[model samples]
Target chain A: MARWGMVIDLDKCTACGACMAACREENNIPASGPELAGDGRSIFWMDMLTITEGEYPNIKKRMLPRPCFQCENPPCTKVCPVGATYKNEDGLVAQIYARCIGCRYCVNGCPYNAKYFNWYPPRFRDEEKRYLNPDVSVRPKGVVEKCSFCAHRLVRVREKAAAENREIADGDFTTACQDTCPAKAIAFGDLDNPYSEVSRLAHSVRAFTLLEDLGTRPKVFYLTEGEKHGRFKI
Target chain B: MDDSKYNELDEELLLRPILKTGKWFYISCAILFSIAMFAVWVWYHQWSTGLGVTGMNRPVFWGIYITNFVFFIGISHAGTLISAILRLCQAEWRRAITRAAEVITVLVLFFGVFNIIVDLGRPDRALNVLKHGQFRSPLLWDVTSISIYLTASSTYLLLPLIPDIALLRERKTRLRWLYRLLSFGWTGTDKQKHRLEKAISVMAILVIPIAISVHTVVSWVFGMTVQPMWHSTIFGPYFVVGAIYSGMAALLVAMALIRKLYHLERYIKEIHFNNLGKLLLVFTLLWFYFTFTEYLTTFYGSEPTHMTVFYSKLTGHFAPEFWVMVLCCFLIPLAVLVRKKTRTAAGCVVASIAITIGMWLERFTIVVPTLVNPRLPYPRGIYHPTWVEWSITAGCFAFFILLYMAFTKIFPIVSIWEIKEGRESSVSETADRVKTYLPT
Candidate 1:
């Protein structure tokens, strides 16, 4: 019965890219070799986008960290021919790799371009293989993959809470990105629970979702960097 | 009917290809088969190595594979729309080109379906679309419509062929058993003729809407998506119109080739091409109208995301291909076809060839430009198709022609019996109808 969500506070964030690195480590996303990376085949569950505003002397750099928005009205899932991708009751958009025909219809339908396709079989260096996260399944070539909000960690936390006969607390289940953010900018919790930090931050006057006019109803909210920093247009 | 006249019709038109095996036929077959085999090898390489062999990436997930899928499927409309509608309207010239058009429909539909499989990342898992297909998806609608169209069009092609098969069986050709098996025990009895006519008429009527639905559903595969340029109310009609336009052009090209190669100049005359040229002119004008309205609305509305795609085609990397498409699909066809003096068989052939290429580029322009310019700016994706994609595409075309050539050898490319029927009975009926139209 939980409507899980994430709220990212832009004011506190530094463009350190720790979240992206942590996500790569936590998920089994393969490293596209330098050649493929230059070709824009890099697999990133968490991505950092840099925007440059204004002319010469007045220029400012703003870093935006993007993960899947996990929309309640997901356009990607709607276009998938097979039921390869679907939104769970917990508000996480999940992909079933085995069922994916790799038609890439979902990839085309997605407006945010959050989805990534495995063009080649995932490869990890011999040493990196030992460090691969055991909780995540390595995706095969030809299927699509994307951020899952560390739903595996949420499952572990839920099991622990069930064993203790206690409900999951606000801070119990956090995404790898939320856990690794050095500035403590990312907050993840059940948005339906008013007491949760994500819920409270989501209600802030400055909070907004990307492409809100598209009516995707994204659960990932962004709290604007206060009046001093210029408002993010997109 | 005069016995010598009937014998001459059968000997000159229907039996010549079946009875004789030219060296050129074998040579062409060898070349086409080898090219097709090379394409197969390229596909196997892609299957083993993964889709990374192609030039597709994040935003450009679909490229030429999807383009070919749409292009071939659009070409399929040639047979069903032209043959079926012409049959329904009782156009006498249709007797020469109907079988050719119908054959193109079935063979091109096969390759159209094949292209989708080649595009899939997990072709092995393609059956999952049947097993766990979501009806909400436009792709499911495509599966349903295409399957129906295939079945209906194939049946439409087969129905008229039965009487011809009976004729071939009576001739006792080298493949006597094959003709006997296919003829389905037709004796040319009045009852059998009536039954065959009923079946053909029913299928002819049934196939038109199914053909229309197939392209409309294909368009919805893009239209139903929330992607910037693809999500439009006009896509369904636009795609259907484009399909018919391209299909007409393909039919013209096929007719011209069959007329020349098979020496059926007497059966398929200048008048047939001239009539079809006029039809092509109508489609050319209509295609232009649709293209004009589609872009004009996109430009006038000036939605930012739509504008990105609009400008990408109008002035960006796709501009050259886009203008070429305009010239091929519209201006050249218009210039050649609108003028009565230039609307010769050769002119029609040239115009049709241009439209076929133009329509293919039109599909490419529709699919690639939208994806390269994503709604959210990460980077503008570039898609440069590799040899693997190119080979597979080449293979698909070769396979289509090979199948068609093989079909021509085994069966009559033009419906001989229908031509006979039109010659014997339609003249009297047509004269009577014409008399009614004339002032007393």
Candidate 2:
């Protein structure tokens, strides 16, 4: 079984927010409108974590595009009483939207704060509904939704690969955020495959996972923003 | 105030509210019932409109509902644990007060469990917890323990009540049918009384552990999580202490109210409060120790994640609530309950009211500040409970009082047989028991 993972190179990222927009469209995440957004009810499958450093005019800012880390030892899934969120065989942490009791236990359990609860039913104008990705389900209000590593794309690609009598290859499935990165910052592939880009990127000296000491063992890695040093610089 | 009334201290005063309905009782019932109805409507509004009616959002996934859940559950501990302990110790003074305390446990538990359901984003699908039960989750542990506690506590509340219900059956009241049905054919034969007393004694022994487990499990709901300040070793015992502290205060307030409303001064005397007040003093000290240890450990350890939440409560946005909680749960209660001059039944009630409010704030502080200050650099979440939360909270308190009032209307709030039994035999039993324990 393949463990789907991601690596985002901070040095290459421009933080233009294309990934956020593309993710909303790909995942059918509803536009929560300004009022709800201001109330902290806004849902973002691929959100930007803006890191501001230094002070005054000398300030440095870097936006890190964040998706669910899909931890090997996911604390979120462990606390879900209903087993609504779980790590599937392919090693992607996925949600069973229908089964979610919306206790929000997993939301509180996750150290990274990756999960988002739907505060309202997904709403769109009659014309806007057509723009929603047919492959994605519109999550109901009260249930949590998060990054699925574009699992639907994986399913479609798997079917295609089977029909062609071949293995599901690298680059066959890519997350919306990874596909939309103009600077080629985000990498998505089978982390177990040593030949895959994500696998090599993840082994880089600058590679780090958010809150590694938490023991969540996140599959998502980040290449540090500044100068690349030490071993495996490329 | 009558000399004749003092001459005869019997079940007549205890049964007065049941037999003769007071005007204020009906008035309070109507008011409480209307508020409860309004709260139901508000909850429905939240249900139909989604949980968004409350001020809860992304980071602050829980708010007043969780606070109320913990608060009510903590209050519930006041009843069963105290009554059980008193019964186990054979405290003669517990006779008039145990029923009042037990009723609080049985009644408060419903609200405590219901707050969790109401807080659910999908209350309709709550059965998912049972269907696809994950034992690993602390929430499931809570579900299991609390249900066991509810069953055990309700049984505990009812077991001692059999003799009282049987006595109520003797009176030719309108609801004599319920009394008869509930009394379980207790003809008060020596054999029946012996069995009933044995059953109550066994349950009294059993309930203390169950009661402790319930609060500890409740604490684990937060403590098990990896949240900064929450993931602490002291939480289980700390929460149990707080539960008992709050429970003690709640029981005092309840007893004081019943004493005034039901003209139960002859039974629920100042001395009962005095004994409970002494216990309350010990708990007040214990609560302070736990609070100090918890915060100090967090403060001194200086774990950045823990510090953020600690500072938030200590001097940030939650400073007012934190200090007030300290005042109510610690300082005021300590000041009022410590002195011999001020530690009256009236003083106990005043301190209890403060402790109840303080404990609720304590729950709020424990739940919110951690979520608001997450480990990540996410913007800090500020919680402001909306009208929906406030209304439901007020309604629950009002309804709890209303239930207590209703409890008095149907049955004697004071156990008839136990106190009568106390009157007949406690003196001799104590003398005999004392001699057994006395060294030659």
Candidate 3:
């Protein structure tokens, strides 16, 4: 009955892409190199956006790590033709690979650009294959894949918690990105728990959600640095 | 009752003598069917290899498959709406065009539904739509509405044709067995006439809303999304207007083609083209208005997510296609249709093709541009169709043409019974009305 959420502190973040790489590896995402990137072939689950403010010399650049917001009222799930993608009870958007008709309506419906389609069959080098997360199933060609909030890991964490005869603790579950942040600016916990770190941090004046006008009611919150005006560009 | 009047009636009733067996007809059909089979082969390849074969990618996931679906469905709307509207208005000229238009609607509906399956990654599992469909999804709405529209349209298209079939059955003694089966025991009695009138009336009334719902549901597939370009309230009426616009153009094209092929220039005169062109012009303006209103609101708001997609369509990667759609769909067609000399059958033919192609490009522009411009921007997504996608798309067109051609051969493409009824019912009724209205 716990609702998972994340608060990313923009102040400590220095735009390092280590979180991106770690998340990709942890999720078993296939890397799409140069040839396919602009041609609609690239597949990146968590994409980082750079938004710059002010004129040159006084320019301030901000890096925003973007993943699926996992909206409570997800537009992506509403348009899927075959029930391939759906929002679970815990508010995590999930894809049912076997049922997908690959109509790509969900991909088109998602405003976040969070979803990635497998253009060609996934190409993994020998080392990359060895590094693949055994817990997550590798996606085949045509079907879409995106950030599942490390759903597979959550399952393992839940099983462990159950074995201990207790519910999941505040720190028991975390996304690959939240666990890998070098700056420790990211916090993940149950939003349903008032005592949880995510719930406490989400109420900060520095905390705000993206595209609030869209009415998506995203579970992910971003806490700005609050040091400079217009510091967070996008 | 007089001999002279009866002979005049007979001549009017038989516009053109029905041509029964022909070797060339059979040969052409076989060739077309074979081509359709080849297209099916390409579709099978797509089924196995996945969408990777097509030019479509993540952002451009729709491409030709969705475009063709919209195109074919738009074309199908022509017959039902035109016939119903004209019949309700009591337009006498509708008689000649109704049967031909109805046939187009039925054939194109079949093609439209087939194209969706062709676009599916797992078309074999299409049955799951009924088995496990979610009511909240717009896609499920589309499935339900399209089926309902198709059923209502087919019935509407065929009900008027039955009397025509019966007429053909009465004349063709050699093929009595075949006619007897298709005639559905129509006796052409006063009671039968009353029953047929009632059926046509009910179908005509029901078909209009169903037709509107079909396109509205299709738009919901895009509008229900939170994607910047697609998430507009205007999408419902906007899509319906586009459907009718393209549908009208398609009807005009079919009329021209049928007139030429069947040498029915006398029946399908310049007036029909002129009237249809005028209707097309109205739609062209309406389409422009909708596009302007939809874009102006998005532009004025200047929402970054909306602007990214708007700019992408207006001056970015999709600029060429976007402008081309505007030109072909509205500007050029309008120019050609406005002038009397260019509003001829040939001119209308060119315009119809333009409108059809333009509408398809519109779908592509709408689907792909928004996808490339994500809410949280990454590197812009790119889409290139693989050969399999191209092959499958081509095959779908071939399949449609094949179905239409086959349909023409199996039944009289020009509904025999309807034409006879038209010929039988038209002149006398007009003369009676004229007689009643004349001052003594």
Candidate 4:
């Protein structure tokens, strides 16, 4: 089984939101509406948070693209009363949409605010629904949803790999965010494979997980910009 | 044993059925219950819609729903702890008060559990908690412990009432059907009396710890969390003390009301209220001491997270509520209860009302303040329950009162058998004691 992971290189990345847009479209997430901002109804699977540090005129902006960390010891998974959410055999914390009781215990228990509750029955344009990937299940109201790392794409990769009589490749199961990154800043692959790009990037000196002190052991890593980008802000 | 004594007992038994048929009894019940039913209809709207009906939002995920949960649960501790502890301590005045307190426990426990469903985004999914419950979670512990306590409390309430049921069965022929069905063949034989005594003894002994665990577990639901204000070690004992404090106040309210409404002045006298008021005063001081220590340590530590919540309660948004709660729960009650003049029935009722309100504010302070001030740099949370939340909360209170009303109709609110036994046993004993102590 693959130990799925991602490494985002801050130095190589521009502050473009192409990855965010791609992730939303690929996952059929709702576009940001005025009423939904900070309401837990906005369905941004890939969120861009801008952190500014330093005094007025010397301000710096660092864009952090956050997805669910898919922690090895996921607090959200641990607190889910219904076994609706759990860590799979491959270490990915998966959500069983049908099984979720909509307790929101997982949402309250998650420190990162990675999970989002479906406050309303999902609303989408007719044309947009037509474009949605048939493989992913649309969530109902009250259930929580989050970035699944395009796990449906991985299932497709597995099927294709089986049919072709070959093992899955690193690029074969790339998430929508990684596939559409203009700067090639995001690397997604098996971290256990020594030769995989994700493993190589993950072991970089600047690679770190957010709130590492929390002991969540997040599979997602962020690579800070070098001395030239000045300082890591916020 | 004599004709005059029999006439008095007969008069005592007649009072319950008469009250059940009082002029506005059913009319008032209908009006109050229809309002409760309307509230239930509103709850259905909440069930269909999402939790958006409630004013809960990001960061302040819990509001009045959770606060009411804690508050109702706090009031429930009044029953088993006070009654059982007093019984064990051999406080004879407890005979009249125990049933009142125990009934509150069962009703409040039911109300408290319902409040959780009201808080849920999906009330239908409540079974999922039991089906896939995590034993390690404090919530699951709460489910387990509270259920056990409820069962024990209900049994304790019923066991002592068996003899009374038998009395109604034998003495009152008109109410023979109910007495016959409910009395469980309670023949006042020596062996039966022995078994009843043994059962009551077992329950009184066992219930005290279970009662204590219920509130301790409740406190742990918040204390186990890493939230700034909630994660205190003192929470367990602090909650237990608060429970007992408020429980005594509830007892006073019930006692005074029952005394007036049922004319149970002989059973529940001024001495009973005086004893209860004294206990309430002790808890008032203890609760104040705990609050002082709890806040003083946090203030001295000056940790940003703890101090934020502490100052917020002391002099911020919650300051008015906090100070008012202190005055109502402790200062005024303490002043009134200590003075001989103010320790009367009306005075205790006022003090009890004050304590009840103060305890509710305490629950709100505990639940909301910590939630509003999370440790992170994200926006601080604020909560104000929407109409849906308010209606359901009102429905819960109405349901509690309705249950108590139903209980009074079914059983003698004054514990007729206990009063008989007290009258029989005490008169002889008091004369002997008085004679023994004279001119000593």
Candidate 5:
């Protein structure tokens, strides 16, 4: 059995927001125009958060990249009246858009605010429509969507591995964010395999999960910058 | 009392709305119906466009629709629960008020259910909650409990109306068939009365828990979340108290309005308002107690995210609304009802109106502030309800009034037989009971 996980090294992250862009492009997330975005209607499955600490010249800035933590005990799944969102056996938090009634209960339940609602019909330029990913279904208005860890890639990888009659390779499947990360900050793989890079990185001393005390047991891990680095004092 | 005089009073008071069609009634109905139709058109626009027509956004996904849902549901608590409790206690004053209260419960609950549908992004898929519902979710609990409460409340409302329906049927009014179908040949025999009394008693006992559970479950829709201010052990009882508080205020307002408009002052007397005002005062204190405890614990514990929401409500963006709520729900009611001089019928009316507004604000405060300041360090999301949302809200109120108006025309707003029963039997029965209690 595979337990997919991710490890994002905050020290390596540049806050370039490419991961957000890549996730949106890969997942077919809607584009809310500037007017709607100003109202906080923008959809970003992977988001970049910057925290500023201290005043004046003593200030330091820290950047945090956030995606769905895919908690082992997902609060969002627990409150979904229609069972539209659920944690799969392979440890992926999956959202069935067709089943979603768009009550927005799951959107509110998510502690990390990873979920996004399609407030309007997804907008695509005439040229951009041709570039829409065929593998991924374009979600209609009135459903929730979030980062799926590029779960479709996993499906393709699994099919290839099965046809080749061999075990799935760690390097074979990577999330779009992981693939597009300029600094190679995000690592994705089966956490159950100790030999996997994600498992090794997750075991590092500085490795932590966002809101760890929430007891969501998020599959996503973060290796924080060491104390000698410009980690914010606060 | 002379039977002829009593009969004349009944004929004039109870039958007036049915027998007579005044110009004011037609005008009010036309106005209310027009506003309600306009709201329906707005909803149609939303259905054609999307939820984006409203002010809801990423983090603050729930807006005024949810606020109205909670508010109307809380208003529903004013009906069957209060009426049932009063009936169980054999309070004589309840005879003039229970029908109005129960009607409010039924009509308001319909609006409450509609608000949920209006809030849904895909209202067409709403039945999926039943078709593929997961029982584990608090939302499912809400669906289950609310449906049960609605059924129980409607049945409870109908049970007492049988005798009245029979009365209307006998009179051969305009809607005679409707009354006959509803009356079920209720002949007012001893057996029939005994059955009706038994049913009302059983329902009175059954309805309290269902009514309590309905609001408690509604609270859980927020409380069960890990959101800062919403996750509280006190939410169940707190919401129940709030519901009853708001419900009492709604009932008083309705009673006062009916009294003035229908010339029901002789029946819905000053004493009813005074007693209901005192009850409102008790709930006001209770609501304040819960609010104090809820906020005090959050303030003292000072969990970073929780404190953000707490401070936001206390001294930040939500402060004005929060303070206004306190003033309307607590200060005004406390000042008015605590003093004998100001606890007049008019005074109670003022307090009731204040509490109704206060309770609506309370629901808004509870829902929005927490979402605006999420656990994550996102910028505070601003929620300004769009005109569409406002129109829908206005429409809901207009619809409720229209339904209530139609109901008053069809049936006696006060339970005629119950009042007659009370007048004829209770005086002698109370004397016997008082004698039995003396030196026993």
Candidate 6:
């Protein structure tokens, strides 16, 4: 019923990578270790895409953080042989790690390259183990994982709302990445609520979803970085 | 009645492989068994550890296992579809070769399915596909179609083997009990013959579509994905053609070996090779046509996302594999098979080996290029298969050959009864049928 969504404004964003760090800390994703990382096996839930535009001396660089699109018409969910990945009524794409057969079909199906697989059993760095969020699951070896839009926070908020006989408010379900953004560049709330700041920002002309022409209709919208910043403006 | 005179020689040749065991059989089996065992151990290590034991990583989540899955399934197309098509067309030559082809279909399919299981990150939870199957997935479509194909092809195989088993039963082979149980009390009665013929025909018709659909669904596993180069309309027919091409090559390889080892040359014949070579040539041309159109369309479109993958295969990191595939699947095949002079059994086998390797490369190029160059900006993923992946792949091939060898020993690779029927009935029936095609 919530139709949860996110909007990231490029102008304010500094690409600090605090969001990525916070996501793993909250979601319990592991550091795949240097050996595995060299094999291109780095595990990330929230990640960044670095785009280098123009020639060497004239180069312009942009770093855009990427989260699961939580697509309205998800290519990933469509191809899961088991119902391990599905979009809930709240319009959030959810992965059931216990049910995942680790076929990686969903990973291949994602156009954004947003998903990561647990090549080894979930490993936590010594300091990471201390901060492992109890509410989040430590995914087993071999299952695919991605940013869940911080759905666990929503569950806790929902339970609290239910106990108080009140409906969940838009800001009550913000993702860890949105909360961690020092620039306040990330906004998350119920997209269905027209009055919500996230929804208002999503309506901005600069806001666009990745690979939108493919019609995935991602709930995650990115506000274009530079238009008046220079040329590369759509 | 005079058929017994000719059948005696045919029986001696075809049945010798079954009646007598060879020293090479033990030696080869020993080699194959060890390779398969090593692969098993590697798979065990992967299970205890993780898929990281293989060379697979992000982006390249699939590798040789998926390639083998597609390749073996393509190889499987060699038998049932070809045999069924030949049988339906009333090709008399099919009588000697159909059983061998059908055996490949039945046995090779298991490994095709096995490759999928081996590729899984959570193979232990593979049953989840069955428990919570969503038909919406192309993978579920693959499961359903391949399972039907395996069942239908194996039954189709068993249906035609009853009369052969009866022959072996009468001969009192060492596996008399097996022959008896499998023969279904087949007697040479007119009623039994008529029923068997009808059943075989029904299965022949049924198996063709099932075979075609299996490969089509296999292609859809990629086609349904919106990945660059993979989302194409032609993938269904393209995959089916490739499957048949590689399958025919595998059949030739197997037939050549069967002929050499068991000395089935007289029965398998130069003429059979000649006909199959011509067929292989046609497929080679078809394969080239599909590959040409597939790439040419992408190149022409110049769609940036697709061009990245397209250029990767043509002139980039995958160029070596891509060009070699063209050489193997098209150029070499066209050279060896096109000229009638060099289309001998040996020539066919050489071309077949090329085509098999080429087809495998084709599968790898198709799977990897798109994944490596992700749609979003990231470092292009690189894949180098670990020893575990290579060992398992080698094991599957050895395992396939080993099973095929065991099948040859247990059953007459060439159908005895079909050969007899061809000698007795097909000769007269062809004359009568050809008469109808001509002016009286």
TM-score of chain A of each: 0.95, 0.94, 0.93, 0.94, 0.94, 0.95
**Winner by DockQ:** 1
Question: lDDT tens digits, residues B1-440, model 3?
Answer: 54213344442333343444357656866776776777778777776776666777666567767777877787777889888888877677786787777777887887788878877766777787887788888889989999898889888877876776676676644556776787789988999989998999888888899888988888888888777878789998998899888888878887897687656775678998988888888888999999999999999999877888899999998899999999999888999998989998989988999998899888888877776666663556676656665666666666666666555544555554545555667678878888998998
* lDDT minimum window of 10 residues, candidate 6 chain B: B1-10
Candidate 6, A52-149: lDDT as tens digits: 88799998888888888899999999999998999887788899999999999999999988888988887777888888899988889989899999
Candidate 1 lDDT over residue span A151-213, tens digit each: 889889999999999999999999999999999999999999999889999998879888888
Give the Cα error of residue A99 in candidate 5, in Å. 1.1
Residue A209, candidate 4: C-alpha displacement in angstroms: 2.5
Query: What is the alpha-carbon RMSD of candidate 4 to the true structure?
Result: 3.6
Provide the DockQ value for model 6.
0.77
Cα lDDT tens digits for candidate 5, B49-134: 88999999978999999999999999999999999999998887799999999999999998998999999888999999989999
Better of 2 and 6 by DockQ: 6
Better of 2 and 4 by lDDT: 2
The DockQ-derived docking category for candidate 3 is medium
List the DockQ of the predictions in order. 0.83, 0.61, 0.55, 0.37, 0.77, 0.77
List runs of model 1 lying over 4 Å from the truth. A56-58, A226-234, B1-7, B436-440
**Per-candidate TM-score against the hidden true structure:** 0.98, 0.97, 0.89, 0.90, 0.98, 0.98
lDDT of 3 by residue, A1-234 (tens): 888888887788777877788888998887777776656677667677777778999987778777788888787888776677998877799998777766677777776667877756688878889889889889876677888888898899989999999989999898888888899888888998999999999987888888787788888888885574323444
DockQ of 1: 0.83
The pairs that clash in candidate 5 are none
Regarding TM-score, does 3 or 4 come out ahead?
4
The digit string of per-residue lDDT tens for model 4 on B1-440 reads 56214347544543564334686667768877986898889888877877766777666777887788888888988888888888777666887888888899988998888888777766677787788777766777888898999899989988988887777776644667987888899988999989988999899999988988999988987776656777799999999999888878887998898788777776688998888888888888999999999989888898776888898899988899899899888888998899878998889999999999999889889888876775544456667667887888888887788778778877776666666666567567657877987896
> What is the DockQ (computed on Cα atoms) for candidate 5?
0.77
The residue-level lDDT of candidate 2 at B113 comes to 89
lDDT of 6 by residue, B1-440 (tens): 46534557888888899888978789989999999999999899999999988888888888989999999999999999999999999988888788889999999999999999999989999999899999999999999999999999999999999998898899966979999999999988999999999999999999999999999999999999999999999999999999999998999999999988998877889999999999999999899999999999999999999999998998999999999988888899999998989999999999999999999999999999898988888888888989999999999999999999999998889888888788877878999999999976
In model 5 chain B, which range of ten residues has the least summed lDDT?
Answer: B3-12
